[model samples]
Target: MKYSISWLLLLLFLPFAASAQTENPVYDEIAPFNEGLAAVRVGNQWGFINENAQMVIDFRDDLVWNQDADTSIPGVLGIRYPQFKNGRCMIQKLKVNNIPFYGFIDTSGEIVIQPEYLNITEFDQENAIGIYVREMYQGQNEIKLDIVEYIFTEVVVNINGEIVWPIMEREHALTAKRRYEVPKLRAKLIGKDLLEFKTEDNKWSVKKLNLNL
Candidate 1:
């Protein structure tokens, strides 16, 4: 009976000891409750820690920030970042091993989806909208005058990376325009009538399509 009692006490104390060791660094900042995760900055790197002060996600990238305004987490174009949806946090990042690509990963650090396209947005209702740009090139000195074609594709990916449905494809163009003495290319999503693409060109014309559609 005494051995059993001691075993129970040890089990109870083990959890507390583990919790104490997992305390988040004071300098590490946590996001609001809505953000679902906290971003802690250690030295020159940044990572994520759960509410229990446990290091759920380790520091890996040079710039780690959140995109949610309420929580002020790091947001970058290519790096994978966590986002809150339906009270649950989802992580999305650009996976470009070859050409520019994008994909999504779940909270448990599993690649639920594989990287395949040029760009991807965070999943909403198991659906994500993406855009692909094909650059138009000219010869030698004329290459500078080349244009870019932007295509929009919407896909539905389940938590297991299964494609449930494929949506229609839309295309748009980008033209050069002068902004503050600098030439920039602006794209408009054709059917949806949204401004979706932006780059430097030199003159104004509708050539690139936005992805919001």
Candidate 2:
């Protein structure tokens, strides 16, 4: 009687395969659906996976989140939550790479906005504001505190590289007191879809306003 080697091999490996399956079966926890997909945490990284447990966006980062439509697109006016929009998601890249920079990435994981800004704030009034700061030091001792002067400035930018508005020299200082006494500049979204900045000095100005809503 000739013994079939292939059958014998299959029988010998079957128990090992069954044991492997029993010990290492894949376990999946469903992720919450957002914008037609969901982000899942696998091991230590987070990525977007579809309902079928297939990876839509591979896990590559320490953290991840979704962005909604208003937050993803440029020029939409209104507050947007921290999530992805229009295939672009905001993420914090490497922290040790320098100043913690926040930028947007497409679904393909391409960075649309390079991480270069110092800080990215929550969407406010239809715009996400980025802040960059320059710090100056003044050696003011207790005896000669009034003699020393310190100045600080903050530059704000939008995703489109537009300077929506700037808080000038003295006004940039967080502790500044009445540095520029110019009347409070009031920003109003006017009828023509323009931002009308009116000052008490009768200086009427107009700029296109990006409404996120």
Candidate 3:
């Protein structure tokens, strides 16, 4: 029996072809893999793809406004990047009236928190994230349509989505912010036990995150 040269070449390349199918499959858009999976966009829908290139989470399930009648003809170009920290990733969706809201989803693709908040940061190992609600304010410049500000209203929440701190008063929150000489107080590390806040004062302070103040 004589084996043709083409047949021999095909056999030699089959293993590589099979590997290509399962390894680093190219995607139109991809995000950095967090934990074991990363968010990927197929046209307009978003879903999670695992390291092995498996579609662990269906894109349709978590996509924002994909099935809505009011979705733009072009659709949203991209959803927020998915970065799984402490097994929870932030996801976005449209409100019943067609407004955008944010929420959290677990690695299993379950909605851990319903999409209701206006803005959210990724939860840390402490199960804490900064939740901001949009507030319109009067600005010194009247030429602009309106001035927008974020009150650290619900500053922190545990992984279970329970408020660690009660709702912060807008006036009080602003007053407290002014105390720090720093122009901006940035929270670098938000651990459960404590948070490290650094101020433009060029000084760092460890404040108990659940301060009643």
* Minimal lDDT window, size 10, model 3: 70-79
List, residue by residue over 22-99, the lDDT tens digit for candidate 3: 775566678788889887876776788888878898775454432233222211222245557788776777542354
The per-residue C-alpha lDDT of model 3 at residue 195 equals 65
Tens-digit lDDT track of model 2 for 76-118: 2222322444445566654322323456666666666665443
RMSD of 2: 10.3
Per-residue accuracy of model 1 over 1-213 as CA lDDT, tens digit each: 999999999999999988776662465444543345665665555566666767776765423244443332111243233444332233334332223344544555454555544444454454444443334444445656545334444433344555443433434322222211111112323332222343345343443332334
Sort the predicted structures by lDDT, highest score first: 3, 2, 1
All candidates: TM-score: 0.43, 0.43, 0.56
C-alpha lDDT of all candidate models, in order: 0.44, 0.48, 0.58
In terms of lDDT, which candidate is strongest? 3
Q: For each candidate, how many residue pairs have backbone atoms clashing (under 3 Å)?
A: 16, 12, 0
Q: What is the Cα-based TM-score of model 1?
A: 0.43
* Candidate 1 global lDDT: 0.44
